[model samples]
Target: MHFCTKFLIVITAFCSYSMELKQPIVSYILNKINNSEEGTNSRADPLSKNVEGLEKLLSETEALNQTEKIYTVEHLVKSNGYPIETHYVTTGDGYILRVHRIPSSPKMNASNGKVAFLQHGILCSAADWVITGSEKGLGFLLADAGYDVWMGNARGNTWSRNHTTLNPDKDAKFWKFSFHEIGLYDIPAMIDYALEKTGASSVYYVGHSQGTTAYYVMLSELPAYNSKIKMAANLAPIAFLNHMSPLFQIMSLFEPMGNFLANLIGINEFMPTSNFFKYLIGNKICAEDSVTEYLCTNALFAFCGFDYAQLNKTLLLFIIKYTPAGGSTRQFFHYGQAIHSDKTNILSDLD
Candidate 1:
């Protein structure tokens, strides 16, 4: 009798599971049959309508919500319900840069009224400041804190690849600039634009990596712009690279032959926004569920420190898609020169 009871219990559980699995299929079949019987004239099934409504709602919500992430800096800002403005500045040498601005925020009502210029590092764009989401992104945080934030993209990057005269795609002259031009031309144009628009005498300048390098260049080459800066903050400053990481140290060894390598690759604009990265790296290797995700993390660990606690595993996918956001071969070659010479000089006197 106990054996029979156990068998019954197993059979009952199986039947219940089968019903659960078959319900959706059964409903679909029934709906089709009912629709056919209705001679294609009846109003749509309410259930079907509800399901369609739900799907539409989800797509719309996802469009507005950037929790999943996006590639455009301005869209990323708007999706987070922040005010964003796109300003184009023509540099002294004719490089047209796309600058992003968060004019004000609900958090502080523009009470501070001071302009804060945030510049991105090598191979990056204005998007870098706002990619980490609103809560953590420097751009958003600054806006929330009452400062008018302006994020600048250096020339040869994804956004700033435009020029008044030359074409970025076909013209080698378009890609001829290094960070020196960025500091001399790009910074002054962006800073002057921001000040003109906001009517602020001087901006609170903040830079990261090559951004800091550009700031130093600006101050050194054009001392007149010094009066236009309220203060300066440099993050991970790239002033003196005498103690650069082993990875850069190895890469710098090829600085002498940088021109040869650049020619070999036919790389005028290096690593622009492309499908190669989006489909290959973003959707495949660096994807959260991908088996080869470690390659992404490990690569960062190799360049940056291997601090597990600091790594945001999910954010890696977004970073991979947006970054290597295009730069010139000369820009990187300059850094390689700096690493070799153990100096902050933009133009190497070693030649």
Candidate 2:
């Protein structure tokens, strides 16, 4: 057989064997417990708690499940001289988005009224650029430096989880997107809003990692955005995949199988990275009371929130905070496409 034909055979076998686990096992396990209960007087087995690390996992699960713990302006404004305000705008497709606006720094004044808008990659919200580690996040840092700043959360993250006309959870159309749609849709709406809100004609654009990937798609697909975007800076760019992480290497092995499993389930749905994050936070490594535990997920729970609650006080006092919203499978396809094409292109395959 030809080399290409041989490769296909291996991929076919891999796809046939991989297991797809999208359904929540927690609900299933709870149902099993309830079904086995004897009577009103009967209770869950006292020993149920004796399962290896169940209590610890449950506690961590509770912590990880939290949604949207924001760092208040009281914490943000005083620390940095710039005042911060939040904004919400609807997409052309009529999805209402949640965003952040940081006023320009008082130290410098410019007439052009130019500002920078920062965007995050898949499975991430605006908070990824703003919160956690060091007081001046990407958002505040730009604002405090005298450039007005706008931070955006792509659809499906906690904040942008609403629609002008379509509910993402209820409308299949809302979820029908690859980073292609994101680049084509979300970024423009954000730019128009930033310009209108800041009274600027054009703004500087900077995206890190996946953020940069979207920029390339938007620029190539909608050339107009290229003109609107003055100075697009792509950090750690991934237009192609020669330098992909080891994780993607594993994915390459199971791409055929994973694709089959993916189709069997549905679109925009894959094993959420949080399952892994939950595993880390809920296992013995769970340290709700410890600053170290909270920092570990500074990327995931940041959007779900980890501040000011009955949560491990360490989650609250971690002093520094940032949340990395998880990405959908569509984003990964965009990454894969860019890497495969050896240039940035719209995400058309996986949505």
Candidate 3:
């Protein structure tokens, strides 16, 4: 057989195997689409329609016997056969944040005290570092490379939803923070906690997307924090928003109105659970048999530029399950402020 012909044969067989394993999900999504069309009328309230759609999605997810549930950072780390530790660090503003650590791994032997810190993006948790599994995940890679790996969850995310005095649900003050607070408070606390625990003088920092944004804010605003890090590696660093996605542009336009309504209703958190978002983006688009899957995936790549070779279709469902974990409305507004500003700085004034 010709070389190109053999490659095509291998690709065809892999895709066929994937499709066979995903048949249950495809059938579930198809049934949900049909049921949604029949049960929901055009005049139905948007909220009601979304709730119905979310319930159906949840039901189908529960019915899938093959789907493994790994919801939290701890769950993800433990599943990969690595020893994990949970440490809670209290910020200067009294926010208690959860930080996950992989102190030592038997697979790789190196100095036990060398430290490396990993931070997640906006509306994401430490689980983001482990979602790709042990082979490819940066956390696992760092751990295997003999660095004491630590992953920090920002204040408003699912992992760090606690305060010393204020209740996150009842107290608006608990929700009244943005990346500025995260940079100045959360980052320092995590770094200090890791150093104190490991007895290390300086640690290496690695951040992705909003993680990189917060690091910039920290170093710029509090230049003294520069001493705590040995070196920094920024992945997909986002400093300015002069060129934003179409969806973000639309969001920027409505930000003022959204802020006003949030103030009027005393709502400081934006789409905490985001069931509507899950239903619309997670189910409607990522569904295995959906015709619009290509469009939805392309939409994700529109801003960053698509690389089909880098795409991993197999992890789509699990990715959706844990993402949009939660963030304060202030975080969204902060990004909006960045988009509108000419300067590459953290938005100082949220109100």
Candidate 4:
């Protein structure tokens, strides 16, 4: 399929799906996020004043929704009434990554159809594509639209935390990869696996944030893979660090120092958890009607341009629940290097 055509199909599906929702609720949420611009100010600490009350309210609300929590990608897909298949792809570096597939949906006859590979961003997992629920998420939407949808989980994430030889928990070598290894091994492994399973010559590639970064690297360094991809759709692509989020700007300044600290502390893995993540960011910042809701939401939009109208406050918890699914410290350090050097290529220590 043509790139523009595929994009339009996805957009049209999203619009049609959106129109089917209870507009009153959607409209109210949109209006609140849009009109309350003053609440999203970055200068103020959103959680500083009412910390105790916020924590209490969030705890109570979480207790109420305890039965509804979806943790793994398999649980997420099956809960949404979709048939999902789990495939394991072993990277060249021996890391075993999990890929999720939604072969068909009720809305379309997807047998023998074009395959669409969805890759998540940094510190994310396959669950990121489906966290927004069945009606809104791209994974479900693509499946319903008749595309054979496959979501990739990069190595070192929640889903891809295993290796053929080394144990992730004890082996320091397992965490020795940047996105460079992800591009060279993970992407190709998933691509080959998906194409072989579906008997397809080429597949459409859709990447977001760091997903796009790896795609660019793969196409640039190993051009042979170009023949295997039909079209590449990059969302919020991050090739240049000239313009960065304030949070990242501050982190960039401490890249070298942070790397030193990581080595000193012997911390290899970054924030990868279910319970802690839910309690921290999900409950504390995004629980329903929390005082600091705007702060957390705004930080996200500030880093990746705010689209108030599209901001659904209700889904914030789901977003938090699935994101920061964990990655190597080196992956983040690699981006930090890019930020300091202002170059896209991987930097050596001597550089």
Candidate 5:
């Protein structure tokens, strides 16, 4: 057989085998759980009962009509009966970021006036923490536990695409930053604001992916900020890129051409969120029960790894509405450089 034909055959076989393995296991486990829960107290088996209840709660949002839904982190928080406040922080470098806060729950104020700030990963926004909604969203859960929940949107994403003078659309300089700037400027500014507002000397910081990268940059560049944070929880923290996945390692080979590729495509600001894409992906494709829903799930698995049993099918649509919120090509290229060079915590080419 021809080389191309042989490759196609192998790819087809792999996909077929993967699907065969995925579907049956998921179906069997779900069916088994449902069968075990039916018409039984099963209180003795709290784990099974909790799993079933959790699944039911996750699916509850699936019934919301498309018209009734407002696709935003603030809307999700408010509609679920939690009070949300929108605050803007201007970074030292002039990028204006929109931050979200769940100040208090119905029962009490922030735990002894404590403050917690949540930061999202690359190509994401503050919406990530609360997108799953009240039942399971970490933002809401933290609020209910009496912690002041604050979500920060880094510059270049959906929420922080503005600057004091530079227009993101017109000024290439506005798109000049990577996650390095976010750590060096944005994180400290937001944290200072949180401390000033809450009168807390320090904050509990939580970050995911590039959020964690920003934290590393802040500590590396400005060690004084360490005294300002009570504790930091890094989720899927990314700094060293010496051991990347095979797929990303291959992509890093083009690091030498990063600037050329970025310029050739005329892509300074990458994947900015807009209403058109929100509707296309959220309403048209990943809408509840849509046939194309699997495309979104498969796409996520392609990059993030596959854990079909842990995938929340119902909130997939809402997540599609908010993600890839926007980023800069340079930010991505920086990661590529790190992976290719086997560097740890190298913020930019100049560094």
Candidate 6:
């Protein structure tokens, strides 16, 4: 090819790329607007800029939800559902996620607005709240304390594995949801259901790990749900990605590889070595027999016969059943920045 022709081709490509970038913004203002200049909650646009490092955290959160679980475990225990794993099929172009409701021991009055909704971390199921015989888990404790507690297993988790409109195993649309989508879509649905079931106007929210991240998305993307949230308690929450668990660091490198693996396995959230990965992750959490008993036991915090090793085993089994086959690569990176900063203030975006 002539040198001049080659140069012309390169110039054309560069110009085309620049134009493509500008087109979206121009289209948004001219075509995407509804004469309000308010593009889908302009209030959320700045996303509470004054809240410390939230703006930077949320911009990346939506991306991190796509990343996969780096570590895994081997379940020494087994998978046991309280009432049973329930599926809510929404007619959408994404995976059909599952939800699990943890059963509370007999006495639960909800304590008025004190009912709590427990959202598990990534690769976790509702069982995370009650792995062992101990009832001291946050979910169990809430229930024992006279608060109605309902644990949730999001769409990809083993429990919420069916969809009304998407096939995660075969359809490209099945993997369309990111953690952000959970906040924007699932939380509201869950909240509405919880409210109806409990006959309460509002309920306390307890989110651990990715569970908390999803709440941030809901709080940021759809501010309306914020009003429904009575009080939100974040346990080991990763609002600001800076101070995340060591387990999450590896996700940054693994994020790009997901697409290939999904294509290879014909899925998005499944861990190649799930059994092995579960044990690896189970070790990081509280696993001491004494700790599990004291921590997971009811309000009394009595010994519940759960050994540290058993806890690890239980935790592993829980992970295998819950972690979805496909994680959102884009959402994972979005949250990575927040993990790096370690700022819970990013949580204020929900306010």
lDDT leader? 4
Can you give the TM-score per candidate against the true fold?
A: 0.77, 0.65, 0.77, 0.77, 0.77, 0.55
Off by over 4 Å in 3: 1-69, 273-285, 292-309, 347-349
lDDT of 3 by residue, 1-351 (tens): 223223333433333343344444334333444555566444322212455664675566556534434466788888899999999999998999999998877688665567999999887889888889999988998898889999999998888889999998899889888888899899999999999999999999999887988898888888888999899999877787766544455456777777778778987875464443354456655555454354344444433434558877667656766776788887877777666654365436465
Expressed as tens digits, the lDDT of each residue in 145-211 for candidate 2 is 6678787777766567677677655565666566766777888898988888777788899897667
lDDT of 4 at 247: 48
Please, what are the lDDT tens digits per residue for candidate 4 over residues 35-56? 4444553433323335575466
lDDT for each residue of candidate 1 in 95-168, tens digit (9 for 90 to 100): 88899999988677545988899999887888888889889999989889889999999998888889999998
Task: List the global CA lDDT of all models.
Answer: 0.73, 0.56, 0.72, 0.75, 0.73, 0.50
Q: For each of the candidates, give the backbone clash count.
A: 0, 15, 0, 0, 1, 58
Q: Tell me the spans in candidate 2 whose CA falls farther than 4 Å from its real position.
A: 1-49, 56-82, 105-112, 133-136, 170-173, 270-324, 337-351
Model 1: per-residue Cα lDDT at residue 66: 53
Those runs of model 5 whose alpha carbons end farther than 4 Å from true positions after fitting are 1-69, 242-247, 287-291, 343-351
Give the local distance difference test score of model 5.
0.73
What does the lDDT come to for candidate 2?
Answer: 0.56
| lDDT for 165 (candidate 6) | 62
User: Candidate 5 at 49: error in angstroms?
Assistant: 44
Which digits, one per residue and each the tens of the lDDT, describe model 5 over residues 174-271? 98888888999999999999888888899889999889999989988899999988999998778777654333455578866876777676779987
Positional deviation of 52 in candidate 4, in angstroms?
Answer: 12
- Candidates sorted by lDDT, descending order? 4, 1, 5, 3, 2, 6
Model 2, poorest ten-residue lDDT window? 299-308
Q: In model 5, state the lDDT of residue 310.
A: 86
Model 4 residue 169 lDDT? 88
